[model samples]
Every structure is written in structure tokens, then in C-alpha cells.
Target: MAVAKLLLLILGGVAQLYGQTPPNVRPPTEHLREQRGIERGLPFVKWCCFASGCFSRPPSSSHSRTLPHPHSLTISRTSSHLSSSPKPPRSPSLPPAFTIGILLCVFGGLIRAYCYRALGAHFTFELSIRPKQALVTHGVYGVIRHPSYTGAFGLGVGMILCVFDRRGVIMSLVASAVASGGGSDNDQAVVTATLTCVCVTLLCILYFGFTKRMNNEDAMLEKHFGEEWRAWAKRVPYWLVPGVY
Candidate 1:
């Protein structure tokens, strides 16, 4: 089941890469961009997601690591040591947490596709109103005013966890390095602190940015569409999540 899920994710991701329509690229206003707070996190987050993929594969008898084996390290306050035992073989099964994250990734990916179809060419990564663009209110928008953002938030959570979990990319890399150098537990502690800081900052930035961006869009649309926007806002009061602001 885990292999099947991973296969599905890989196939879906490949298909999306081949034929995805990117959101509108027009830069948002300076004020809006500042409120967005995604300038740095965007690429940082993406790099983390992509780099984490190399750690996901099961170790095959056919392949070996150039660096110290990530799983060989045992760091303690007294010392860091490497295991001398030959590695045991394992299947491609995923951790329960990772499996849940992958599910969220797929769910969010589908919702993003839905939003792309619904919005057509109006979807913009940065806040920008196109000339004479019609307001989109049917379908997902009927449930929540900012469905794309909901998908993004879900996707972002999955992506972050995939790289930051206990048995994840960060720990794997840190373990390998520590094993090679005989580093202390402090190294792991520092990494943990950094990861926690990044996650907290990411959540805060995204929350404030999504909220600000949505309201900014609403204000712009209301100005442009007059009663049309007002009626839609009246009908759907929620922003990203339904019934929870």
C-alpha cells in the first residue's frame, strides 16, 4: 500500500510537471508583497522539498551511499559512534506519519488542479488584478473564498513534514555528518531548534500573508465588480477554510 501510494504520488507529480499551468506571475504591489512574506520561504521551501526526495528510497543491494550511511550514526552526550554491523534490508514501506503527509499532498494537489480549472487564467501567485478579468465565484469558491490558498496550505504542511520529520531529510543528513565527524548531540539539538524556528515562522508568515492576500483580493474585486463581489462575499463569508476564517 505504501509503495502504491508513493507510485501514485510520483506519477501524479510527473504529470503535473509536464502540463501544469503556472499561476499569474505579475508581481504584487510593494505593500502587498511585504504582507505576502513569501519572498524567501518560497525557494527555501521548494529546495527542501526537492532535496528530501533522495532520502526516501529504500536501500537496495545494488546501490550504496558515497557519504556515511545516514542510519549508521548514534549521537550521544558522551560520544558519537557508527555501527559496524552490515545494514539490514528493508521494504519500501513508509512511516505512518509520512503516509499521512503524502495523502495530504495528493489531496491538496487535486484541489489545486480544481482551482486552476475553475480560475482558468486568473490564478495569480502574487496578488494582481488582470484587466477586465471576470470574478470567479462558482465551484470551490462557493465553499470557501480562497480555495487555492487552502490547497497551498495543505500542500505546504505535507512538504515541510516530508523533509523535517524524525525519520526525514534533515535528520538523515545530520546523522551522516555527525557520524563522519564524531560530533556531539548538540549538533542534533541545533538542527532541531532551527527546524522548529523555521516551522513556526513559516506558519506565522503564511497565516498572516494568506489572510492579508485574501482581503487584498477581496477589496480589489469589490471595487472592480461592485455588487457582484458584494453578493459573493455575502454568500461566502469564509476565506481559506470553511466556517473557520
Candidate 2:
């Protein structure tokens, strides 16, 4: 009888603990948006949409000859059915710490948006080979050749900033260092996640920091404008940081 009572008490405690778990611990997507604010939500959607399909579709046949507007690019033969593709699974609602983390991410995002607005037509997340595409050397680009990259790196750090108390920052820094340094890992799951995040962060930064994106854009420009791009390239000797590279 004593053993039976103890077992019942143990079960009761387990149930109580489960009940004590906060509903806010895992709220809805709308709730997360509410926390991050509407201004930041749009950019999050834009990046998510871009990652989902916007960047993957091939350009239209005439897209190389002439610059297609953002809307037109979406309706092209290669992209017409992109919306029909199966949607990716949604992430679980943000936890408490994640709410704070998203705010930090928003600050970084705003920094990039400011740079983008300053860049206007010069701002592109992908490599464009259009004739009208000019080498942007004004505003933020004038100060830091790859302000976009610095903003993005800041975003990566921000996403985890408020998520884990004291240990969170330490863990995030370790992860960043390990991933950036290309440290090896024995665990397949850990290795896969680390490498994926690192690769994506690097790619985003390289889009503005490295010459590869510029070179690809130049290839397109050379095909279209030829001498115009040659002259521009001469003026912009380095792809990223002006003095360093």
C-alpha cells in the first residue's frame, strides 16, 4: 500500500510539473510577429521567401539582355509555377528568449534596410548582369565596401543574443567561431547544422564582401554593356573593403 501511494504521488507531481509549463513558452507565429513588430516582420518574410524560392529560379531568356523588374522576374517562364511548389514546414513559435533574440535581429535588419534604401537600384541580393547595374560607391558603400555583409554578420549574432541567458552568448560565440573557422565535428547532426549555418552566413557576406558576386555581375555586364563595366571595374579596384583588399 505504501509503494502504491508513493507511485501515485510521483505521477501526480509529474502531471503538476507538466501543467506548470507556460503557454507562452511556445506561442503562435502571429504572437511572434506581434513581439517582433510589423516593421521587422516584412523583412523576415522577404528573406524567408527569397530563401524558399525567389533565388532559385532561372532568369528569363531576355532577362540577360534587359533588366526585368522584381514583379516581372517572378512571372517569367522559369518562375511562373514557383508558387505552386510545396511549401516548407513552419518553425515552432518563438520561445521566451527567442522573442528577445528576434528584437536583436530586427535591429540588425534595420541597419541593412537603411543601407539598402540608401543603395536603391544598386542594392541587389543576387548577382545581376544588367547594363544599367552600376558599381555603387556612395553612402554606406563609400564608408565600408561591404556594409551589407557587416549588417548580415550582425544579424547572425543577433538571432541568438537574447536566447540563452549568460550561457547563450558564450554558446553562440563558440558556435560562430567554430563554424567560421571550419572546425571538425564527429557528430553528424551537429556537423550538418553547424556547416549549413556557416555556409549560408559566409555566402551572404561574400555576396557583398568577395569579388565573386561582382565578377559574375561583371560577366553579365560585360556581355551587355562591355566597356561601361570595364571602366567601372577599373574605378572600383577592390570588391569589398577598399584599403584592406
Candidate 3:
């Protein structure tokens, strides 16, 4: 039952990401965008999209020469389809943490979907507001100024947690560490401490990146929309988390 939830969450998220992508876009442009990202700074802007199977190798590159328009995306295919990855060698099952991660992913994807519907043509992974784009305030935007960034942060953290299960990388490392200690009580404590530190570090890093993106978006929207943006921001003081952020 729990595993079903994880798979369904992944699929639903993928559907939202890919189904919303405009078809006229292509992959070589995406490659060029990443190249520009590398020149500007770290390429973490699209990290959450990867977790939900949004990035894929561009089909033959001959189709795309010009950079894709800012409003439209060119995510070519979904390489990490759940039905396609090699059947994970079975263990007892996915961990409780994996289920927790799945729930977070579901929550995040639903938020993104809401933003998509709210923003309509303005919803995009790239960060450029269309000319005369109205500042969205209904739905999730009514409470949070940058709901998309909030959703992306949750999606990234959930992806990290999902990797700590039987079929993922973190658990394998944990098991090895547990074995190396000869199963001592001290080993258990050390392992727990180390794992906690690692997870916190990762989540913190993801949060920081998303926060930066949100701040940038806020500045850009305020510049573009002027007083209209200011009014929306005033009403929705929170960027990522309500009452906390």
C-alpha cells in the first residue's frame, strides 16, 4: 500500500511537469539553457524537476537551434519512468521514511499543479515574467507569494528522503556502516548521528537555494509589477512557509 503511494506520487508529479510543458519546445535549447546556467552560477534551478522525471536526453538535436522562448520549456523526455527502471531488488519493503517522502512529494506536486492552473501560461521552470503578466493572488498564491518555490523545496527534500529506502543509495550506505561497527550500541548511536547530520545538511542546502530563488523572484516581480506586486506581497507575507518564513 505504501509503495503504491510512492509510485503514484511520482507518476502524478511527472504528469504535471511534462503534461504542462509546451510541445513546440525541444531539447538542444534546454542544453543551451544549462550551459548559460553554468556560466551564470550553479545549475540547481532545475534540480527538483529531475526528481520527478522531467529532464531527459534530447531526442536528435537537429530540431532545435535557437534558444527556446523563456515562457515555454523544452524538457524532451522522462528518463526515470517508474515502469522502466530495472526492478529494484526486493528487501523487506520501502521504509517508513520513504512513505513520508512520498506524502511530501504528493503535497508539493499538488501545490505546483495549483500554481500551474492559477498562473496558466505564466507557469514555467524558468524565471521570466511575461509582459503584462498579472500577479497571481488566488489559490495557493493567496497565502504564499512564491508558492512554486515552496513546492520545489518540498519536492527536493522529499526526493532526498525517498533515496534512503531499500532501493535507494542512502540505506545501502547505512547498512554498510552498521555492519562495519560489528552491531555495537555505540555503532548505532554514531550511525544515527551521522545520518541525521547528513540529512539535515542536504535539506538545509536545498532550502537555501529555493529561498534565494524566491527572493530573486520577489525582486523581479516587484520591479515588473510595481505597486500591484507590492500589494500582493503585503497580503501574503510568506515566501515559502506561512507564519514562519
Candidate 4:
């Protein structure tokens, strides 16, 4: 954990150093030549010299002014207009949902580790139980029959949120809209809503499938342990949740 924290701090420091301009640093100035060329309606050009010693030059200013060109291609210096135009409002910083997700992932991983440690000799990658394996009804196992599955589910949720889930998407859209100095458009709102629904549907599907698999595993355990498993099940009653399956 200390190593992880140190690594995170290092990465954050590096990102901060590289990602943002220093307060003391001034914005780059436009070159006088480029500004003059723009004002004279000349096409922007770069002088390139090859190893073979080939060179090229843009047309002279007089010839450039008389040449027919699309209006869209013309460069206009509208610095005053731009400066006067209403700037988009700075977006308010959002709660650190990604950090929360990372915490969840860490917590889930710890839970899984605890579960495995509690299982000890009985812990197996496969569903099959060893001949002398005893029922684990202490620690996390006491609370949930499938503690590993609970951890796995938590990990899945954490990963979803960490990457780009409904929460992240909504936060991004809200931030973008706020930065653009307006509320989301109807189309954008619709898309957001649709994506949210899809995310929910996918979560529900995963939950349903996981529960179905757990039920099958429970049946297999019951067959293996018979009355012992029945009594434990009666005591616990729930698989992943307390008082709720």
C-alpha cells in the first residue's frame, strides 16, 4: 500500500507538472511576420529544405492578393471581436468519482483477499471442494455465502465507474454543457438518458446472471454438504446481501 501510494503521488506530480502551464509562464506571442502575412491575406507557408537541397516559396504578396480563393480559406484577424465575445463560464469542479471508484476497487480486492485467507486450505480456483474441506462460516463467509463473488461484483462496479459508466458520462456531459455556457441540448440530453438506461440494463443483466450462477453453485454445495450446508444456509439466508438476495 505504501508503494502504491508513493507511485500514485509520483504519477500525480508528473501529470501536474506537464499538464498545466505555470502561473509565471506567459502565453506565446504570434510572430510579427505571421501576423503581417495574415493581414496581407497571404497563405500560411513553411520553408522546407530536403537533403537533396530542394526549396519552395509562397507567391509574392501582390500576386497572393489578386488570386481567386474561397472566402472560407481567407484568414480574418478578429482579435477584438474574439476578446469582446462572451467567454464560456469556467465549469465547477466535480466530486472525485474516479478516486471513489479506485477506493472501491481497493476495498473489493481486500475483501477478496480476506475471503481467500479465511478459506485457507479450502480455497480453490474451481468450484470443487476437497474431501476434508470444512465449511467456512466465519468472517466475510458468515455475512455472505459467496464473499468472493461479492468482491468480484464490487470490482466490476468499480471498474465500470472508473472507466466510463453512467455516472462518469453524466458528469462529463454536465461539465461540458457548463463550460459551453449553456444547458445540454435536447438531443444531447436524450443521448445521455439513453446511455444511462443502457448502463442500468447492463448492470441488471450482470446481476441476474451472477445470481443465477450463484444459485447453481449453492445447489452443488447443498448436494456435497447435505444437512450441514442446509443449516448454514438457514443461518445466513442470503448470498451477497444481508436480508436481501
Candidate 5:
């Protein structure tokens, strides 16, 4: 019950985040126009229509001219029929895994926010340092050399967890079989279970793999900060997680 409540809270937070608009950025009319543009640009609805065979090619000007009046009327009726048809049933729900994933994502988001706040003026999306950028060795930086990456890794793990289910497992195996071109589909449930275990193992491997990026960042910092960076590295040897990393 507590877990369920927590999940609902996380969902509410996510919904709020999705609905949030940038403060004082634009007039209401301009914002509405931008929102409309974004909605039109999104491929989700189009993909859904295509998948359900509801999508039809728009009538070209030439094609429309060639079509007789009666045929055009029939086309409109066909479109109406398509629209009136019942939608496919919803997929099976996997609430437990999804809720856990959302929790992890929320935690990760908090970590990212903390890191961003701590970095203040020094943070940049690019590898290049600002002219007056100081080496941030306090707060979140003191603990992790790349807290932002840590947050991103958390998000990745969360996303994987989100889809980690029987269906996901089966799909993964199917994908592997297709790629390899030499696998029987027998005992798929057992194969999928094994694949799920392997996926968890891979997630661990990927988490540790962030060390490669850490090394790259270290190199860049060494080039930029020289002795100061070396000193900071000595003080905070851990790239992420104090003892384990």
C-alpha cells in the first residue's frame, strides 16, 4: 500500500514536470502556437495510426483531380469508417516494475538537480571549460567526479527496469535470434528468463563502463586545470560512489 502510494506520488510529479512550461519565456499566444507545433511534430500519434492500419496517404492534388466526384465521396466515407472502428485492446499492465523504475528515475532526477545546483556557473553541456570556470571540488563534485553522468546512468538503469518484464524478455530473445539468424523458438519462456538475468548482468557492466567517460573527463580536466586538478584528484580519488567505485 505504501509502495503504491509512493508510485502514485512519483507519477503525479512526472505529470507535473511534463505539464510545466518555462517561466516568463513567451506570450500566451506564442506559447500556444509552439505547443501546437510540438504536438503536430510528435510521431507517436502517426505511428499509432500506422500500426493500426488507420493511416492513409493524403490525396495528392493530381490524384484528387483525376478522381471522380463519387470516388472522392467514397474516400471520405472510408475515412469515417476507419475513424469509427474500435481500437485495439490495451496491452497487459506491468505496474510493479514500472513503479519501481519511476522511483529510481525520480531519485536520479534529484541527484541531477543537486549536481547542477552545485556546479553553478562552472557547468557546461560541452567538454570545453569556460574562461573563468573554476574546478568544482565541493558539494556533489567532491563525492563524484561526474555526478551528472551518474544521474544519467541512474536514468538509464531506471528505463531498463521500466521495460524489464516477461514481454521485454521475450522481445529481447526474439531480437537476438533474428540478429544471429540461427536459433529455434522452442522454450522461449526459459530463454527469455535467462536473457533477463543476462540483461541485469549487462546493466551492471554498463554502469561500470561509465569509468571510460570518467577517464576522458579526467584527461580534459588535467589539460585545463593542470596542478589544481591533480590536487583535487588526489583529494577525491573516487570518480563515483566513494568506496565501491
Candidate 6:
């Protein structure tokens, strides 16, 4: 029994020594082997083995410096560090032109709403055959037959106000003149001077031509509403510009 107890104690001591390493133990050489395996993109744990074919125990921490291969951790760190910056936010600066545009938009919206309300059931913003549609003489239509178009023209002026500077404003005015056949832009300011002359000439011509056609429209209305249209015509003779007819 004494011999058996001694044998048991010896076996226990040997088992303990083999199972647990010393507290001050250095990193195993297997770490180098593991690192090498990682450098070649191989599994460190699978390749880890003792010379006598015994498999090594895993490191205590997964994040330990003892990788299966030497440089596997390095490659991971580098790849992670090389990521690009994410997308940036947009600027909040409002340009002068944009500001004016917003105001013009608001004015246009208000005008449209007023016209719609004034016209009520007879109102149609589009060119549709509302043959029975009565002439709108109240609100905006009392002065201008096409108040919406007048508002649109005013809105154009409002848009020009949004220009960043006086140069922008002048350029815009010149562009408008060109569009209206008021004048062309020469290299000199002569074009701007001529713009007014051309615009006035064009306006007189349009007034005679277009206004005559519109007056003829009153004849058609006269045929429909007869004396009623005549009375309205006398009250609001001018179509676009108010009080000048």
C-alpha cells in the first residue's frame, strides 16, 4: 500500500508539470511557426504541432502577440489602417440669384392663388374650351385680362433681383432686352443704350399688332355677351398695363 501511494504521488506530480507551464514562462517557439503559417495565409492552430507530433495548446488570449504566423497580424493592421474617409456634408451658402428666385417663386405662388380664388368656378389656368365660362372682372382680372402673365413678367424682374451683384443685374437686363428683341449686346455699352430704343419700338409694334387682335377678341365677346362686354371693355380698356388705355 505504501509503494502504491508513492507511485500515485509521483504520477500526480508529473501530470501537473506537463499540464501547466511556469508563471514566468516565455512565449513558445510555436508562436514563430504560427506566425510563419499566417504569413503564408495558412491556419496557425492547424499547423501547430510538437516535434514528437503532439499538438500545442492554444494561447490564453485570442489577441495575444503569439500569432500562428509572424506577419499575419501586421497585414491585418495595415489593411484596416488604409481605409478612406467617409463622404462629407453639403454647404449651406445661399447664392444671391437663388435668394431672388425664392422670392419670385413666393410672389408667383401668391398671384396664382389670388387669381384662382378670384376666378373661382370659372377659373381655368390652362387653355380649355369653357365656352360658358364667364368673364372674370373682379380681383386681378379687373385690370389685366391675363394677370397671370403679368405676374410672370413681374416674377422675371424679381428673379433678376437675386443676382449676386450689379454686373449680374446688368447682364440679366441685357439678356432680357435681347430676348424681347429690345437690343443686341455689342462689345460696347452702345448695345445697352440701343436696348431701350429697340424695346420701345418693339413694344409699340406689339401694342398695335397684338392689342388690335385682342380688341377683335372683344368683338367676339361682344357677340357673346353683347352690351355686357362693351360695358366691361369701357371699364377695363387696357389688357396688360393698367390705367394707360
Among all candidates shown, the one with the greatest lDDT? 1
Q: Positional deviation of 45 in candidate 2, in angstroms?
A: 9.2
lDDT by residue (tens digit), candidate 4, 70-172: 2222333444355767567443322254455455555656666677678765554334555666788888678779876676566545444544422333444
Residue 194 C-alpha lDDT in model 4 = 71
Query: Candidate 5: worst 10 consecutive residues by lDDT?
Result: 49-58
Poorest 10 consecutive residues by lDDT, candidate 3: 55-64
CA lDDT of each prediction against the hidden true structure? 0.62, 0.43, 0.57, 0.49, 0.52, 0.42
TM-score of 6: 0.36
Model 1 lDDT-worst window of ten: 58-67
Candidate numbers, best TM-score first, in rank order: 1, 3, 4, 5, 6, 2
Score every model by TM-score.
0.68, 0.34, 0.63, 0.54, 0.53, 0.36
Candidate 2 per-residue C-alpha lDDT over 31-98 given as tens digits, one digit per residue, 9 for 90 to 100 = 22122222233234334422322111122222212122334444675664666875674433223343
**Predicted structure 1: lDDT:** 0.62
Over 1-245, each residue of candidate 3 has an lDDT whose tens digit, in order, gives: 33454465566456335333432223234322232322244343344445533221111223112122222232323323434655663434434665666566667777766777787776655566665578778877888788766666666666666654433444444555555545654665676677778879888877766666666767878888899988888888988788987
**TM-score of the candidate numbered 4?**
0.54
**In terms of TM-score, which candidate is strongest?**
1
Poorly placed runs, candidate 3 (over 4 Å): 1-94, 166-169, 176-183
Off by over 4 Å in 5: 1-96, 166-186, 194-205
Residue 199 shift from truth in candidate 1, angstroms: 2.3
Estimate, for each residue in 1-245, the C-alpha lDDT of model 1 and write its tens digit: 44564574474343233223355464546413343455435535544454444454432333222234334332331242344554554644455655666666667678887887888677755555666688888888898988877876766666555545555545566666766676656766776688789978877876886676677778877877999989999999998778887
What's the CA RMSD for each of the models?
6.5, 25.4, 15.8, 23.0, 16.6, 39.5
**Residues 73-145, candidate 6, lDDT per residue (tens digit)?**
4676686678676345343233344345435534554564566567555443222224466776787678876
Clashes of each: 0, 0, 0, 0, 0, 9
Residues 1-245 of candidate 5: C-alpha lDDT, one tens digit per residue: 33443354445345323212111222334212223322333334223212221111112223211122334556877877889675674533434554665566566667766766776655433344556668888887887677776665655555555444322333444545543554444444456677688768858755655565566668878988999999988888877677667
Which stretch of 10 consecutive residues in model 4 shows the poorest summed lDDT? 45-54
After superposition, candidate 4 runs with Cα above 4 Å error: 1-96, 165-184
